[model samples]
Target: AQSVTQPDIHITVSEGASLELRCNYSYGATPYLFWYVQSPGQGLQLLLKYFSGDTLVQGIKGFEAEFKRSQSSFNLRKPSVHWSDAAEYFCALRRDYKLSFGAGTTVTVRA
Candidate 1:
């Protein structure tokens, strides 16, 4: 089966603390890896993506991710998180013209 899975359904971190969201997938080939963040009742925002070349990619809202081809994973990380960062994170892969998304991991930042 080719799918993306997020181990944690939810995560809570203190404001100003570091955060990491795990994403694992099973695919025949390296599909286009992407991380998107969605605010409450809002559409998903592109955080980062792994197409080719570099395995590490940076994105807006102070987020970054490293693609590990051997492990079949692409994890999102932020050194310091703010309250506004509290949102849902989704790992996705381009499957044909469609995309497969993980169930999503909700992030809660405590102040």
Candidate 2:
């Protein structure tokens, strides 16, 4: 079985501050990783994904994630976050046709 965990339930950051959302996964073999963002009342949108090859994958909206096999972590980062970045972020793992998601992290931006 595969599972994803997002340690942070909510995070607050000032506008223009750097942001890092932690994600960890557990699986028997190498797992496909993904990051998705969802705004209030909106469908989930893919932010980025890691399948094979590069451990560092670039995502949309100035986001990037690094996959570490040793630690089984795929943490998401933003160099500088904007107020508009406020949303719920989820880390998901896929193996086969099923996708399991983390609890989700809510990011809040203060001006």
Task: Give the alpha carbon lDDT tens digit for every residue of 4-106 in model 2.
Answer: 9899999999999999999999988889999999999999999999999999999999999999999999999999999999999999999789899999999
* TM-score list, all predictions: 0.96, 0.97
Winning model by lDDT: 2
Model 2 RMSD, rounded to 1 decimal: 1.1
Scanning candidate 2 in windows of ten residues, the lowest lDDT window is 1-10
lDDT of 1 by residue, 52-97 (tens): 8888899998999999989999999999999999999999998788
Per TM-score, the best of the predicted structures is 2
**Count of backbone clashes for each model?**
0, 0
Worst 10-residue stretch by lDDT in candidate 1?
Answer: 24-33
lDDT of 1 at 58: 92
CA lDDT for candidate 2: 0.96
